[model samples]
Target: MPAVKPDLETADAVAKPILIRAGVALIFGLTTVFVQEPSTLWMKVAFALYLVFSGSAMWEYLRREPVPVAMRSPLSMAAAAWMLGTIVLLFLSAPQAIGLTVAAALAVGGVAELVAWFGHRRAFLPARDQLITGLAGLGSGVALALGSHLNPHGQLGIVGGGAIIIGTLLAVSGVGMALDVRKARNLEADRAPGRVD
Candidate 1:
């Protein structure tokens, strides 16, 4: 073989998180698969695990994507500050923790945008990619968390587990750029080229 590029460390750094994302996805997928019977505490533990995964994935996606100069100019420090503040605030909110956590995520995403603008000179996305991904991830994850609606016996198997599947769907959506691209092309082919294709 030709000389190997010496980037094992860098490659590992990148692969580690993507692998973690896949693992989390698998956990969620499996949770969905076996929604028939699971312990109450296990269900809660699974959801908690999901929350951690979402936070990690969001953190990675933001830091990796190139900031449009304008967006970079705006979001850097703001996002960093909010990310720290909300992590603490959301955790302390107890029963309302899930909702608070989602709010914090939204704020974190917003801050990322601001950081992007400040660091660069423009907004990274016209559609605010970070916000959309974060919210969907947060919302679905929370929906799953809140699924445990006081069902002493049924919470885990029914509500909680179902929510896990839903949250997994959201997470996949966030990470599915290639899928989106394929969908876009398919839709565009159905339309004429210039007509918003």
Candidate 2:
């Protein structure tokens, strides 16, 4: 039987979304520093777009065959849906309501990652990475929630800070994951018969 050749196109498809998301996160993080008000229309729109991009990237990642089945738990699906829903609610609901919703979603996502970590700890790479990412989400979520309550003005401080943290985290993780995928693909190609580097 002929060996299945590694598909560069497939590899690119998997890596592209992650890189794009990382870029967006980095850009958003940098811009958030200058944003004085979190409730502004532009900020809301940007966040809405972020949700859309994040949900799309997750959907793509879940579609990849290399991802473990254990990682695609119901909780993960719910988190993706919540992100999408938050985009809609950002425009329709009050700022505080949306902020609360985001905080809750982040918390749930963090818990989901923690579960994934414990469930698949033997896998090492994914388990450890998920734990780190999960902790980032959990910490940021808690901070955002606290900021909402502590500031009588608004969640600008919390949101801005959270954006920077989340952005940096996502960007780093995204790049790392992309590089891993690329390396795996290259290794597979090298192993194929008649293939030259």
Candidate 3:
């Protein structure tokens, strides 16, 4: 019997929309700053919109998740919860609060990761990878958020929040983008010169 090849087609298709929305959301964020409609209420609305967008992006990722049926939902929910929880804390409190929130989130994520890691030992991504990524993103994002809210005034808060949001968005995107490019390179390396996916 022949081994079934993994469907790289589906993977690429899934990634496209996910990356597109994320990129668009970043641009929209920047646009909001330019429009000068970034009122405090408007900022909260932006945060809510971003949350919805993140949830959608996550749904796309989960479609390709290597976890089992029983585990996938829990992990997805956990990921969403942690992401939103971190964002909420950032908007509502100080950056230092992120430290405590991250500590708590990682603790919960650690347990779930440990369980999933043992259960899904065959996957390309170990559970701990997700755990670490979640924690690091939450921390940096909160720091950026806190930096934005400093002594709200005309020039400082305006530029500050803009820089912080854009900076964190780029930072978060960097890791995923690098991985995507690396994966494509590896694919190219494994195939003939004229071959492409």
Candidate 4:
């Protein structure tokens, strides 16, 4: 028997959550880069909220994959742990500590992606997505490390700038996806038996 394909509406509905996440990230990134000198309390609260939101999105993204339980479960757990550690370090107002924590988390996640790509090459779709994401994570880790060491006080701007760029990219991608979904829906409707286009 052939595999049943999902309808256009179903596909669009499934993608809605991811689109929302991308929008949220884009907004947060844009807003974060503008705060010249956030107070310790503000940093703690902001980081806490960011971790919760981003961590949930990451978990959901990974969980939606068709990878093995062992791999996905451990990755989900690592993502959660990374968020918790980063939140704690941010709350302590330790820039270097936070940077190191983020660096380590990114590095670990990146390596795991590479390993997963190699281990389950057939199961993984989107040819180079895993590799690209992994490399980007590693690169961001290095940048964060350098920023923390060179200018702890200026790290906020560095982080903010990075967030802005990332957020903008995500927002654009989300908008593109939304357009694609709309187009698919329209095409489907046009093909309906009684529809007059």
lDDT winner among the candidates? Answer: 2
Q: Please say which candidate is ahead in lDDT: 2 or 3.
A: 2
Model 4 clash pairs are none
Q: How accurate locally, in lDDT, is each candidate?
A: 0.43, 0.59, 0.46, 0.54
Superposed Cα deviation of residue 20, candidate 2 (Å): 3.3
**Candidate with more favorable, higher TM-score: 2 or 3:** 2
Candidate 1 residues 117-182, lDDT tens each?
344333222223334333443454354346534432343333234334434544454445434445
Alpha-carbon error at 81 in model 2, in Å?
4.6
Against the true structure, candidate 4 has what lDDT?
0.54
Ranking the candidates on lDDT from highest down gives 2, 4, 3, 1
Model 2 C-alpha lDDT per residue in residues 1-197, reported as the tens digit of each score: 13223333334444555556456555656666666554545555655665566566666666766556877783365357548556566555456555565666666666777787778767534345456656766675687676645431245455445556555665676566667667776788889999855
Per residue, candidate 3 scores C-alpha lDDT tens digits across 79-147 of 565566547645554333433443344334334544554565455332334444344344444444445
Per-model TM-score on C-alpha atoms: 0.40, 0.69, 0.46, 0.69
Error of 1 at 6 (Å): 24
Which residue runs of candidate 1 sit more than 4 Å off their true CA positions? Answer: 1-23, 68-147, 150-197
Using lDDT as the yardstick, the better of models 1 and 2 is 2
**Cα RMSDs, all models:** 11.7, 5.0, 8.2, 4.1
